[model samples]
Target: MLNKKIVEKKLTSKTYTPKVLKELYKIFNLRTKQEKQKLRKILLELISEGKIYKDSKGKYRPLKDNLAIGTLELTRNGTLAFVWTESGDEIAIPAEKLGNALHKDKVLVEIIGKWYDLPEGKVIKVIERGLKKIVGTFQPRGRFAFIIPDDPKIQYDFYVPVEYFNNAKPGVKVVAEIVKYPSPTRNPVAKVIEVLGYSDDPSTDFPTIVVKHDLPVEFPEKVLKEVAKIPEKVTPKDLKGRRDFRNEIIVTIDGADAKDFDDAVNVKKLQNGNYLLGVHIADVSYYVKEGTELDKEAFKRGTSVYLVDRVIPMLPFKLSHGICSLVQGEDRLVMSLLMELNKEGEVVDFEVTPGVIRSYRRLIYDDVNALFSGDKEAYRKIGDLKEQLFLMKELKDILRNARRKRGAILDIEGGEVKIILDEKGHTIDIIPRYRGEAEVIIEEFMIKANETIAEIFNNFDLPFVYRVHEQPDPDTILQLKNYLSALGINFKLPKKIQPKLLQELLEKTEGHPLRSSIERLLVRSMKRAVYSSTNIGHFGLASYAYTHFTSPIRRYPDLVVHRLIRNFLKTNGKLTKKKIKELNKKLTKIAVHSSKRERTADEAEWDYTALKKIDYISRHIGDVFDVVVTSVTKFGLFVEIIDKYISGLIHVSTMNDYYIYNEEKSILIGERKGKIYKIGDKLKAKVIKADKTRMQIDFEIYNEEENKSNIN
Candidate 1:
């Protein structure tokens, strides 16, 4: 019999390096094949239990004393990077060294080699599994089956017995729960818990993505019941002690397809030649009290997810689209930020208070934009509001100029794709969502309101949630400068990096051939904005303090801000120190949870859009289109179709001659023909293949001369 104690003692004796399996077997003096098998099993058990570790060379060794804890990031090509949670240091882990640790898994890694600039580590133990369930296509092999996961990060297929099929047959999309985790010698076992539908059914894509991302699509029954008990209209009793803005000419400006309205704007010219701007947001905290089922559910959702064809709201429809929504001509409770600003766009004074508002009109951005463009029909539709719209344009210009002077970074080249779906949920067309003057005006107002509220709460010295964006790392900035220099654009980095320097560079390269590419790179160089309990000044906005004070119906953090302001109002600004301390303890957790949920929602939205794009392109396979090379890698060049904005790979194998990648020049060179392809190069290509399951497309360069000769 193989004993763990004896093997451990021998392995720990005097080993600074890993030991191979054959050497371990020889050390144990195992004579028969059966004994060797038992010894291997014991070694595997020890490795799994974190008593030992494996390196990339397939050698086992004892774990080091100082193991770093981090989250594993796995790429589609099976590469791994470990991001330490505490120190923010990154370590590279070879694919072979990651035994059972999956993508995004919290793991304890032991440093094994320091040959490269960055340390290399091997995952010794998986502290927590990131994925508990997976969505995939089932492939039945007679009595048993295997599930190929849709997520490329899951490198292994799941095994399922016949009895665990849950009535699902082959070629069906299903969600499976992992029954047992993976091991070296055996695949992971899973049971089909939900049979979504056919793999070819377009309607199943939404639900499959929803389940895959663990997004909460529906509210709990208890939450729905609580929503049912809430009043549908603002009564006289509900307006007590609330400032009434019913007579104000407030209007909501949104997209044509917008359903839930959470914010409204009203502007008036004051006697002092300044403007009085009113930004009223839905008071969601009024209905959803603390310690209630609705509040619990709202906190869990964190933020509303806007997918391609649908919206998974944080709150129920009864609140998001009904009484709590700031609909036109409806009495709704709100938290209003009224600011008195001078002509220079400086807020002279501001007041935050709970209020009752009745929006006079609900306007779409297109119509408002047309009105500004002097369209007669649009002017007639706007009628008496045209003058106020003109005044809004003036205020918007002032505010925009003020932000520019303060060095707010503006990278506005990219636009979102709006997928048009038929009644059957099939994608018909994809168009870019335009952002015009009206959109910019609304954005400016909301930003001012958010900043003003943040300053108010910050002055109170109370615990609150803030929207923070940290400055980019120095190394990332230097990399951007180097890339720009390589493209023949002379750029210099200031001793102290500021938003102004980047903004000026963007302006200088605005009309350049690589303008869009440069903007994309600069955007990537910036840090992602997130929610935090402590106020870290927003670097991109150039604001000293900021919070999300608008859209309470869709975002939970906004609702929390509203609650804090309301409590301050109710107590006449006399909150006890003990109460403030309790809120600080609670707000910290909420900030972290909300930030994570927001990221998940953004990822889900991007995934759904990509899937729809793949489906859309699948119909036009073999069609040649003009494309621009967005990036070049060792494998191939990534090109984006001109008008369609769909990106695909032009694999090196598709070319007639062999190609070699030049890392320093960021280009691909043909070995025999000496042909070179670099970023921003325009060429024609045919869509050779589109894989809907993988959400990928492949393209080949079009040979125009050959085609012409063939036609003759």
Candidate 2:
């Protein structure tokens, strides 16, 4: 017979099974009878409170809670409650009370206290309902049907009736509106609003995402009719009360596929050896007046959504892509910003004007970059303005250097993946999109314009929308410092880490193997930039004052800036005091909604693109490729395959090497073998399985190469 004390040590030592120290005495024969009896009573009481559960046979497990009220983030296995307290302390809910709550559903929860290693929360009541519809594949069972959501995080399938199928056939992809959510036994009931088609249908996913997010893809009849009443060309009377830039010889720069041109640039040398540069933005507010159908619709949409293949414009096509596009050879309404800068790129004086302009040419980024870089073909198109173009290039370089010194985060080494398409609209291959000198020229000019406008409002003590980003949390910065400290990367940290410090770190990491991985971590620790009436400084741009004064045709904040500038200019620099109070209140509400919608749209688009990328890679299984571990969890290692540009999972169990998770360090280390596989380490992996339906990929390390070639 085995002694009870020996049995307890065996269980604890072999499996590290979690147990309350007091409870263990109840099951084991202690020398003191009184201690045993007391432990039994306490253990029984804990069991009665339902704060713990026993396994199928008889092993006790803690019931996780630690209560909270938070938005639910549902996952395939369970759900996590994301709670933000009044003091801004963020905590995650335990796996138990996730219940039937889906993503973004606000709910109240009861905290059950902490388990061995994780905080636990249990759902009590749903505080708010999510109105967004789910896109999925329709599964029909005789007269009944259900939609298995495309997002795995949506734990429950939506139930549907035969009549609510909306002409959708079995196994077809569709959009279902949830009518009823799940309780104990039942699933969510739904009504079908759209039948997309077979999962393999060409370009079906694009429109599906647009509709799922309730994005406006078409114009309302009234809005279209209103735009039709506007004149096609600028009239003489239209030039009234506007600065005329007709002789500026400005040109619009965009992509070859771009149709709606919202910005134009002009540069000239001043007599004092200073440069006079103008950034003229299309004055959409001048055409689409307030309280009209066109304005209302645009306000509701907030901003245009640009997906991979299509765009959902805020206004009708007649206005967005035609009347106010700043098209070449056509006079257009503009709000212009003129700046006088010394040869060293320091702004001496700046002026904002409500203006009318004619775009002398519509140049693409690639063409302009090539011409600026001394390509003969590009120079031929520029004709006699070569000297002016050369001076603009010098100014751009100076301005770029100034921004770097000011801690502005520039797009220097990052690359964008662009999908090339065939004539029939099918994807051909993935190509890298590069931003050359021309792109930087526009970006530098736009940043300066935004800063100038922000300063204008600041100096006047006027209310306005400012794009702001606060410094990273002290705790997050400390965590990051500790994380990099272990890797021997040291840097100076102020009482609080500023954007300039972050930018400096980024610059230091450029071209390193760990650049992308480390930059991602840094960015993840920072809050997103947003528009606000509050004048908090922007941390990302390292700017004390920043506003969206460049893209008025697309961003609502820019439109507000346009209106504010017009009001101020109309009164001859005397700030309008009467209407700004009311306008500021309205703009605040607009800013909140616009930011929320923008985040939602960004999430949906990224998910859609990831899905497509996974699908494309699913067709090429058994292919061997080099990969980098992008993320690590208890369950698996996520690796991004270089050849396909798709990320997949490598279950930790398949590492086939003895590994130990160092939780405190957020790393996984191997035992016995000194082989270290950390985040950003390059490894060759062969695809073992690819599931398009689940958007999952499985990989195994290519061990054969280990013996033949030295990985390190």
Candidate 3:
């Protein structure tokens, strides 16, 4: 049978050499017309799937032959695009070679030659359009209208006919769905689907973003109906066959604005120099059964998107914020992971069980952090849970230390942004999100729980979904090593790279002035953490087995994890080999879908947050602020305002003197004055312009002397 697997096995078994159709047929030992036809069809199918590519000479070969399928990544300016191939090679695509492919479009690129040592390719086919609709501002043209896309990488102003304008007036924000994709000579055409009031209206932000990212805004009617049927609170029948932890002092700790409390914790200093730590996560899987409308919607959303203004939930509010939320004093069903750990923070034993719990108290991060800092009022609120709170802190420290010792990268700072809004829904401030002792405690406890649960499933060799971050590509690591050597740092990379190697390098550069630059480069060298059915292990965490087990209310993977745990418990871990085989296929699909949706969520969050950041910057135009140079390119410098936590560009053209880019040092130097601007360098800059439609902010070097001269 000439199926995909058989063909793949035969083709990959030996060294691949470019071959023609007749040669392939001969190789397959097919003489009959029927067999030859089947072979040809199969080969065509493989080509469509990007498994094989036809060389420019009309010979067939595997995709390794200078051709690959991946998303098209346009530069911030959108003049050039690059595609990171499946093999991790970044192939540059020139504007003319793009062939109408938009940014983030899944595309097949045919590599014709090399540009600056990197493979340069032209988009041969657009596999899939990344966006169904785009958010832009409506501009009236001669006989039609044009939409200036908010996304910089869109690269074209969409032309809209007067009839398709949907009554949207000039200067109004509108959502446009492309009716005709662009060609080399002409722009794309679109029809306005939604007419948002104006660019400045805050209410339009979520709608604009939701459509832009294809995010599920409202729950389906079927999903809402299912949620409506779900009980408002945990019932007596729900407690059957579940462990009771209601009597224990469990507390839910989260940010002040958190709507759903998913995980709760309680700690006890056990006898014989051990710690009993309990992690109780809301049992979202119980309420959202597989194959139901609710489950389908949750799977589609994959995870909750928390915007600056509101949350786009994965599940309906009736369940996510009601029964599934671990609210204080309310009985809630939970999948509880109880682990007994030694003083060194190694889990000696653990148990996972369906349980019922009533949160004893709800504590916010601020209060807990204040209590840890010896604030009397904060401690007074702690009251009866003071002893347990301190014990939790001790265990948190031990766990963090153990993780550090086990070679996990702990010092890479990735803080969130706290957007402060006023009653008018305008962004007042954007500050770095604070994660104090309480947040650290929760993070450590959740990680321990996830590891413990994943380890148990791995020990049994079960088919399960694992959160994996594969090792960095050898080429990327080599580049990192070379870059560090230029900075006068001798870093050694092993033949087989390991997390410990990079972790040690980070440790050595902990307090170095160039630590941020190093961190940025090191992070770039590593692959993204993603969901996978097979466990290759998470290199960043240095864990042999790791899975997301908490935050079931917000994340679909956690809910699926909960369901798998329930299955394991019901079957007593006696799954047959055949059953596991079946599960492998199902789990693989789930992992891929969940991972894709997760990336979507991340991108949506980033776009929304960036929009708000630009809005905040618009209010402060011409104001001088201290900024740090986060990146330096030949065209400009990217600087983040120190206090506002907003980044903008200081274009090289605006500088008083022409600047030359120092490629080796990755800095910009003035042609005459030789003033150097490099990463981590602090300088004062004035915001020159802020364009919401373009989603861009331009900054210029602020000269105090020039300002005083002008005033005088």
Candidate 4:
């Protein structure tokens, strides 16, 4: 009988063109009626998969060879780009050739020409629209209204009629549902489904970001009911076949504001002078079974989102913060990784099993850091646990040294902005959140556990999701080399680049004036890390195998790993072929979905942070601050405020004299005054404008001499 692959092969070959069903059957030499029926089914499947299309006269043909499938990325200026999913190559699409496609839409494009030495293409068909609703500000126009979308990539404003205003007033933020998609001659028509409120309201900004990104913020009633049925504590039956670690002095170390405690650690010295490390993570899979309402919702969320003001948890609070959380003095069900490491931080042996643990203490990062710094008060707070903490710290240092020796890329200069809000939820201050030594200890331990678990699963040949980070493309490496050369740094990049080369360059430029800018460029040149069912070595970590085995309470992929481990244990460490295949398929889908959701969460968090920073700067208009030039472009100099670390643009128009941009040297030379501005140059700038709606801040050079003279 004919199958989908056979049909595709026949259609793709040049032996025949489009043919009717009878002609296709004859080409394949099918005789029986059943075989013909199978051929028909195969043709339909091929059409559904977009591998081939049926013509108006009912003949099937393969899609154009020049056609490539990818997602359409639209820039703020309405320029379009198509990023191929398979090759990761991007092709430019002129605005006129974009047709009706929207931002992030799944599109098929035909390669046309070259623009700026890069491939260019025209979108032929939009397979799927990326947006159903948009968050924007409403501008009323007498009888009709329009919404200016908050997302800059959305080029067209959605037109709304008078009756579809949803009682929203002009200048009010709203969520507009698209009723009619845009065409060549017309803009998109939409109806206001919700009115968020004024743009100045700080409370409206966060929620607008959430809605704009389509984050799953609320759980369904069925899922809530399921959460209600869960018990508050582990039962005796639940502890069956689980290792008992409740007697051990396990401790959970986290940030001060953290609520969901998923992982706990314990360490002790063995008789052979080796260290035994215990990493106990909450076993959420034991309660949230597959295909359940809770599981579905958790899978949809993928991971907990840590926004500035709140947390949108993957699981409900009852599970994430109550039962599954490894809270202090709480008996919880956990999946633990026990490893025996030599003094040199090499893993000698390891074991993974379901365990019941009772955490003895919950230590905050600040206290632990102070204790390590020999603070008497912090040591007194830890009391008897000081020795264990010291041992953990020693082990962490050993592990870190081992990792560094193995050439792990450590890009660690960036810090998150900590937004502080007033009682009315208005932004008051923005500060940097620094990661201390205590946080690094926890991170090293988790990475070790993840690598250990991934190695175990890989050896067993079981289906599992791995945290894979492929090496950077050669083009990216060449670009970095060019940029560094322009900066007067003589670093030679090899034809085949590795993480070690990047690491060495970073070390050489550690204390340079352009260190931060170089680090930022290097990071941008690397590929994003994501999850995959296949085992691709993690280039950034210098590890052959890696996976997420901790924080099951917050991350859905960790829960999946726990489930796979639990199933292996239940089946006596053996899985059938059928079960393995099913698991492989399931894990693949999960990896893609989880990676996408994680990206969405990251975008939302960044947008919210940018909004808060703009709001904070809005209150300080006309204030002068010291800034460092991060990059010099033809249009302006991009500068970062030294104190606040907030980046803004200093336009060339704001300069006192005309400046000529030096493309080769990446500097700006004042034509009249001969003043020069380059990256890493420090100057003072006064804030001129802050547009909260656009999330932009404008700055003008501050003349210290003129200000001093005025003061005199």
Which candidate comes out best when scored by lDDT? 4
Backbone Cα, N, C clashes tallied per candidate? 0, 9, 0, 0
Estimate, for each residue in 1-712, the C-alpha lDDT of model 3 and write its tens digit. 6677777666655576778888888887889999998888887767655677666576776766766887777877767898854433578999889987998787888899888767889998777777778888999987898999877778889999989989999999998888998877899999998898787777777787887677888777887878788889788899999999999999999988999989999998877889999999999999889999988888888999988888999888887789999999999999999999998999998889999999999998898888889899987887567778888999999999999888888767553678988887778888766568898999999989999989988999898888999888899998888667655678777899878788889888776655666776898899889888888889999999999999899998889889999999999989888999888877876887787688778888988887788778888988999987777799999887774667789999988898999887878889899888777778899999987776789999998998899999
lDDT score for residue 404 of model 4: 88
Q: What lDDT does the true structure give each of the candidates?
A: 0.84, 0.72, 0.85, 0.85
**Which sections of candidate 1 miss by over 4 Å?**
1-78, 81-99, 103-130, 141-143, 166-171, 197-200, 511-516, 572-577
lDDT of each residue in 310-367, candidate 1, tens digit only: 8999999989999998998999998888999998999999888889999999998999
State the displacement of the C-alpha of residue 596, model 1, in Å, after optimal TM-score superposition.
0.4
Which has the higher TM-score value, candidate number 1 or candidate number 3? 1
**Candidate 4, position 52, lDDT:** 72
Candidate 4 residue 30 Cα shift, in angstroms, is: 24
* lDDT accuracy of residue 343 in candidate 4: 79
**Model 2 agreement with the true structure over 374-393: per-residue lDDT tens digits:** 78998888747667667777
Candidate 1, overall lDDT? 0.84
Please identify model 3 stretches exceeding 4 Å from their true place. Answer: 1-130, 153-155, 183-186, 474-522
Task: Please give the RMSD to the true structure for each candidate, in Å.
Answer: 9.7, 16.1, 6.2, 4.6
TM-score of 3: 0.84
**Please, what is the TM-score per model?**
0.85, 0.80, 0.84, 0.89
